[model samples]
Target: MTGRLWPRGLRARLLLTFVLVTVLGAAAAAWSSAGSASTALVTSTERRLTESIAGQIGAITPQLTYPPDQDALDRLRAAVGPDTLVTYRNLRSANGADTGLVTAALRAAVRTRKRLVAQRITAGGRPWLLVGIPIVITGPDGARTPSGIEVYAVRDLTGVDRQIDGLAWSAAGTAALALPPAVLLALLAARSVLRPVRELRDTARRLAAGDLAARSPPQGADELAELTVTINEMAESVQTSMATMRRLQADARRFAADVSHELRTPLSTLTAVVEVLATATAGMEADARESAQLAITETHRLVRLVEDLMEVSRFDAGTARLRREEVDVAGAVRDCLRARGWLDRVDLAAPEEVLLRLDRRRLDVIVANLVGNALRHGGPPVRVAVSASPEQVRIEVTDGGPGLPGDVVPRVFDRFYKADAARVRTPGSGLGLAIALENARLHGGDLTAGNARGGGARFVLRLPRNLEGA
Candidate 1:
């Protein structure tokens, strides 16, 4: 419950904490002051009342006869005032209404100690002080001896309580007055502390969103300012690093594209020469024919590598464009399989026709790569299933073989990634899955690789049904 009510933002929490500390401090101070003042007032009032009663009794005692009668007691009580009570051998003053204020404990203490004692108590919801004093006579040797006559007086403490109450109210008022100032200070502090934090937060957000140049201005010379400076330095370092990385990537892509272009002409001439050699190998010796076929095979692989590299460069340079056309997806998959002479080896599951707006050539490329990879690396019973929804088209190609290794699934679409590092001379150039994924992404779709429930490697290619709309 407390967590739910607590402020979530840094600024609000800071402000609330500041105000709470200030208010609590003020309340504590006020309470302490009021308590101290109340204690002092009560102590001083008790002392003054005890002394006044003692002085009055001392003055009238000299005139009274020792072991006096009722007359002496009446004179003593009248001298001490109406709230005073005098007793001599069970002779209490007739006007003894205030006698009830003194408890038996006070009377016993006064008689036993033979001196003055006072007690403050509450009666009828009003404060009262009961003072008990035993009169003493001076002997010739200057020694004081107790007189049988004991004096008791009751003092109303209502006025003193009122003053103490006033003091408490004043303290409360002072505490109340501290509030506005505390709130104002809290706001100022919150602004000073949270300004840099808010700026830093915004700058970090911009940096995360790819605005590498984003920075927060340093404010005061404090820890937060130092942090701001550090963050700015870090952002600058990151910006420099990113620029260097981008330049290197661009140069690498350019180099690949340039080399591919340079090799195209020579490769084309070599391909033609290899074709002539292939035709002449029929009459050559067996050893020569085998070597010629080997040369032809490697040359074709080299040509394909160069082409795939060129395609990757086009993608990296953002030069690839889509030629969207209404294509029969099922027909395109079937045609790709037929062209590759894989029609007899693979299984096809599709509706009669599933039409989509897509690039025909890219679609064919995607299917051909997936199917070819399955045929080369996977077992027999390769299956190509096509399905369509309003939003996209899905094509799943699975092979009846061991599923992809755990570590290989994540990098399956990465260029030049091979599952077995030692098997380097596979028919694939290692760019087929990568290129297929790129083509799928170009159509605002995606390609994913995983294991099928039936225990084979699964490659799913999802393409948006309407590229123009996408």
Candidate 2:
């Protein structure tokens, strides 16, 4: 769950990582440059000041009297430099009242009469260098004695501080300028990398959704491009396999249709011969007459079965064309019953004005097959009802009989499926409901079967009102 809080997209994660790296690199660069520049400026300032102050001290010391009057010390301070402070123990010259920058240890070191010492210190929140040296004044004799004059120079470092601050700001600004270019580079890199991945994902989704033709174009010669090529190859394989399967299915259906068509001629001739034989059998012995009648009945059933097979083949081959015309639902239903001599057998309940643009022949075939199926397999009081809405038209057939077994309802409209699993001889070819379903689909509609409310089988043929859907 903690991973949910992380960014879900690759681009955002890449951009964030790039930005962090950029900022860290920039900050490091700024810090390094600022430190070097500040150190250099301070060193240069110290070197120049030390040399100048030492030269001035050398020139002024020999001209001074040992244990000099205050006037000599004042003149020594003036010769050092502007904004420079000089001190000799309790005696000082030129704005000497402010002496806080000098520490007690530095004053003691100067009293030792040893070497020159310099240290940086802050006075009144401004940087200053404190340099101290003890001078020996040679008397008129050939002997030298300590002058006890401790000279101090406090050099103002305000200008050096300002220069160092400016350098720091410049370094920061230089680092800041790098961000725009870094951001642009990050965006370009993310786009170049993620575009192909997005395309491949979309293509994969289309393939999953049954678009076998979906493919991705290979781009660069790198690994991503190789992946794209692999995906395209897989899609082509699927397309080829599906195409072969479809062609084989079409060939099988075509063979069945051709065989059914070829058998029709011989079947017709055989039917005629059987009819003639039936007439002649009336004069023959009783057992021979019974055999002739049995042959005749079997030949008729075979003829019907072959016709149904041909019809199914035509639907499979997409050769079944609709003859669309405006037709009243009630009229279509009534005509379907009358053509089969079943008007007196079934009750019709329909709306007079409900109409649709659909194939009349297919409609009649659908109604006849359903009514015949119900009558042949069910009890009396077969009822047909036609209903309509703005979007669809419906015809429902019901019969007063035992409803279908629970397991048979779902597969009742499958081709060659039988409600009775036992091999009891039945008149139908087991394709009546299947053909009716195909006819309904031809009109861009559907067929469904279930039990009616009063314990009977029900078949509803629903057709869309729009013929353009076909």
Candidate 3:
């Protein structure tokens, strides 16, 4: 899990990233601009100080003795202005400034007499500009040399510092004002990008929920639009495939119903003929009677196959409506076994008061098919158990035979599936379990087949007590 300080949404993250970058850049530019303006003002102040100091020293050279007198020093200070500090040194020239602020480097530069020298120093929390000028005099032989007098001037720069501070504040204000517009622009950008993504997400959800025709509409002409177009194409392909599959499934079901309906007349004729043959062949030769009975048996099996197929078709067509009513679940199971003449062939464990609202006829079919399947393919003692829970009724049909193979258990309810594909002879048409499962589902129930723990096949049917469709 991420910390709450991390944004959980895309829009917030985008907006934050934009603002952070903008703020950092603005801060850097502001600092740079303030530093540049402050340096320029300091440079200009130093220039004015140097020029004023040099001119004062030139003017004071005429009044100075070998060691300058107090009067000459005072004239120099007056020339440099009272707000500035003027000092004469090297020969005990006069000034009120402390000598400690002057370094040996300034004195040496002044001794060279090549150029004026300046330095910056801080005193009492205020910046000061200091300039050094060497006093020179002309010799009678037309040669010039230092006269051994040095003048220094100091200027306070408290006002320049204030101006620089104001510039910094102005820059900060400009950046602060940019925030609202940056956030607004970021929101607009985030909305435009996420709109298409949101739409695509919704479309994908609908498609997953089985609305195959769902599509994402394209927006913009960038990569996002291309993505939308691709999604739509994929959806269209899936829709086409599903539609084709449904058509094939419908055609197959229609063919089964058509064929089953078409065979009814012929099946009726065959039934009448078989009954007559059964009566006529009883006293005939033994071999002939066996053949005749085999024929009758096969014809009966065919009739059952056709009927099961028709029932399955009705389910496929969704015409198998449930006729639900309040019915005793135990009594229904007992009656189903008794009607099939299997009362003595199976074990019954049921509670007498277990009741449910279900289609009794479908229930009967489900029970009979399960019992008959056990008798045909599984070993005894077959057990039919009827029970109930708070919200549902249950039926479990267990057989004592070796359980179905693991691979075949899940497919037992599939139409026309046989556990042994090579063994072609069985009393069943292979549709009994499929019909049973469909009938269970029509009553808002489900049937599942699996191996019982003690060893054998078990088929369980669970039905909601209050059925919805009747």
- Per-candidate Cα RMSD to the true structure, in Å, reads 3.0, 8.9, 6.0
- In candidate 3, stretches whose alpha carbon ends up further than 4 angstroms from where it belongs are 1-162, 187-221, 228-232, 264-304, 334-349, 367-385, 396-437, 447-460, 468-470
Ordered by TM-score, highest first, the candidates read 1, 3, 2
Which 10-residue span in candidate 3 carries the lowest summed lDDT? Answer: 84-93
RMSD of 3: 6.0
TM-score of each: 0.88, 0.56, 0.67
Among all candidates shown, the one with the greatest TM-score: 1
Model 2: worst 10 consecutive residues (lDDT sum): 93-102
Better candidate number, 1 or 2, judged by lDDT: 1
Q: Please write out the lDDT profile of model 3 over residues 205-304, one tens digit for every residue.
A: 9999999989887977999999999999999999999999999998999999999999989999999999999999969899999999999999999999
Error in Å for residue 39 of model 1: 1.8
lDDT head-to-head 1 vs 3, winner? 1
User: Which pairs, if any, clash in model 2?
Assistant: none
Task: Provide the global lDDT of candidate 3 against the true structure.
Answer: 0.82
List, residue by residue over 283-387, the lDDT tens digit for candidate 1. Answer: 999999999999999999999999999999989988888898889999999999999899999999999999988899999999999999898888888999999
Tell me which residue pairs clash in candidate 3.
none
Task: List where candidate 1 sits over 4 angstroms from the true fold.
Answer: 82-98, 122-126, 276-294, 375-382, 399-409, 453-456
